[model samples]
Target: MPIHGIGIDILHVPRLAALIERRGLSKLASRILSPVELDAFCSLTSQSENKRALAANERGPTEPIVRFLGVRWTVKEAAYKALYPLRPTWKELTYTSFDAKKGLKPELVYASLSPDTTPAKLHVSASHDGEHIVATVLVEQG
Candidate 1:
């Protein structure tokens, strides 16, 4: 397969948490997440709410929320960087949605690609620790 480009990003959870605290969740979520992503994020929050009381020890009181936002932000930035030359402004590129692969791996779904290009085929990987979240994107050449 031909190589198009690769992009990677690392984000500090504290930085994003601060933004969420300052700007509020609705505003930040609307600006950053695609409709589908927003839905998924909401679902995650709802799930966390229900589970929080049950498993208070296994999950941190706030890390799940912080990590979720941080991972989404990192993945979007990585996708944007991978498509660098064809870069639309961040707001223009709402095409990169995500889903879970069979083994619970995350998959990138690029919906609004240029006509000349084949459907964007992206390989994505992401991870988060208590302090940081990092992601990588591999954009396939068509």
Candidate 2:
């Protein structure tokens, strides 16, 4: 196995907030999140709605959704960069909790489409700042 590529991306939280305000959360999320990711995204959004109805969270009513979108956007973008020539659509890549791992893992649903190259491993890390999120992806090809 050899290292295929590495990618890093940083996103401002407010940019995602603006996107939500303009396009709405569901619309943007559906376009970016795979089915498994979408389920968790839906749960996050649904909870935000309920929280808003009761009272806005101190951070803000849309805080949770904005953070969710920001993290996903950056992670997917980084993954796309790491994949290089073999571009994968947002819906084709997903991140979710698997096994008893400490954090989530990435899955390339379209991996089968590329018969020659197999992603032996995908090392991912994501972090959030006050109003920014960053993600890094390390790709190993087998």
Candidate 3:
């Protein structure tokens, strides 16, 4: 019924690029992604035409790895914010999808699990400012 916890995070794009270069996207994806998430990531990452269009507009690269990782990080932060109030295990919350409404904002969708209660509602908002990615998460219980 009431809001429990709120989490907000900002990620530097250069930092993400460095992580992808050092650890590789596959490993990061496996560690942080669910099957459905993987599918969505793949869909968003694999779309070259879309990437090119975004790139033409001076957005982030057309490569899916960059977009996918960006989305994954946003979801991770959002899930963290949403689940902290419940104090569930880290693995209990799973990210489902990360997408944008247009070319301007980022969105996150996730599922939270616990034996005693049903999944709570997680509201995620994300954006990019060329230099950094920003996300805000809100958690509520009913």
Which candidate do you rate higher for lDDT, 1 or 2? 2
TM-score of predicted structure 2: 0.81
Clashing pairs in 1: none
**CA lDDT of every candidate:** 0.72, 0.74, 0.61
**lDDT tens readout by residue for model 3, 11-81:** 87778777766786657666667666667666765575464554422443444467556755765776676
Which pairs, if any, clash in model 2? none
Which 10 consecutive residues of model 3 have the lowest summed lDDT? Answer: 55-64
Clashes of each: 0, 0, 4
lDDT of 1 at 97: 34
Q: Candidate 2's residue-wise lDDT over 14-49, tens digit each?
A: 877877767866688889888888999878877877
Q: Write down the RMSD of all candidates, one decimal each.
A: 4.9, 3.8, 5.8
Q: Report the C-alpha lDDT of model 1 over 1-99, residue by residue, as the tens digit.
A: 776889999998888877887787667877887777777777876787796664533443367766767787898799888966766434433433344
Question: What's model 1's TM-score?
Answer: 0.77
Best-first order by lDDT: 2, 1, 3
State the local distance difference test value for candidate 3: 0.61
